[model samples]
Target: MRPFLIALWLLIMPQVVQATTDVYPFESASEQERFRELISELRCPKCQNQNIADSDAPIAKDMRDEVYRMMQDGATDQQVTDALVSRFGEFVLYKPDFNQRTALLWATPLLAVLGGLLVVVGLVIRARQQGGAEPPLSEEERRRAEQLLRDRDGGV
Candidate 1:
């Protein structure tokens, strides 16, 4: 009975230690908080829809470790983020920085909305123009239309 209990404890102890070791390192409370904030603003490359903080993928874990190391080495939050962006490019950042290349990212949706409004306005103006463009009917065509209407209405 004693040996069985000892064996069970040994098995459970290693599992607990392994679980604890799997959590990433942050040097201080401030570092942990900063890491959380930075990671939340970063997209995971392998899991495009997940922020780095929310992803459990190995690449996310590696990115988290890289962030921690940067923080430990006295990198400012912006510097750390810039390092990641430099390595992975703008796609890794949830909120991309403003630059000539990314101007379209910031401008495209507004441009699209404006373009749609212009198209709508053009269509309305054209419709209004067409509505007022009726040509006067010739006497012969008017008489023919009246005859057709009378025929359809049984000469009423």
Candidate 2:
């Protein structure tokens, strides 16, 4: 019974410690709050579309540590982001910086919307043009159609 109790305590002790280890370390409450906000704004390089705060990847952990270190060193949020971008490129930022290289990323959506509108407008104009065109029937064809209608209606 003594051996069994000791093994159970050992297993439970590690679990308890693991729970505490999951918490983020910050020197002050404000630092922790700012760290949380900054992490949410930063992208995880290892996991695209996931913010650093929400990602469980090792790279996310490293980035979080780097942010915390920068904050401790008195860096502003934007400064911290700029540092990460310098190290990891714009892809690491949740919001890519607007510059010559990334201008296409910001412009592509608006261009696509404009292109789609142009296509729709072209289709509508084509449809109206087709509807307005006359069939150019010969006199004989017109007579034949009239005769058929008369026969169907019993001498109309």
Instruction: Please tell me which predicted candidate would have the highest TM-score against the true structure.
Output: 2
Off by over 4 Å in 1: 1-28, 132-156
Query: Which lDDT tens digits does candidate 2 get at residues 1-156?
Result: 999999999989976764443466777888889989999998898896999888877788889889988888899999999999999888887678788999999999999999999999999999898997789889999999999999999996
Q: Model 1, residue 125: what's the lDDT?
A: 96
- TM-score result, candidate 1: 0.68
CA RMSD for every model? 7.1, 6.0
TM-score of each: 0.68, 0.70
Q: Write the residue-wise lDDT of candidate 1 on 1-156 in tens digits.
A: 999999999989966764543465766887778778998999999995899888877788889889878878899989988899899888888888788999999999999999999999999999998997779899999999999999999999
Counted clashes in each candidate structure: 0, 0
The C-alpha local distance difference test score for the whole of candidate 2 amounts to 0.87
After superposition, the stretches of candidate 2 with alpha carbons farther than 4 Å from their true spots are 1-21, 132-156
**Whole-model lDDT values for every prediction:** 0.86, 0.87
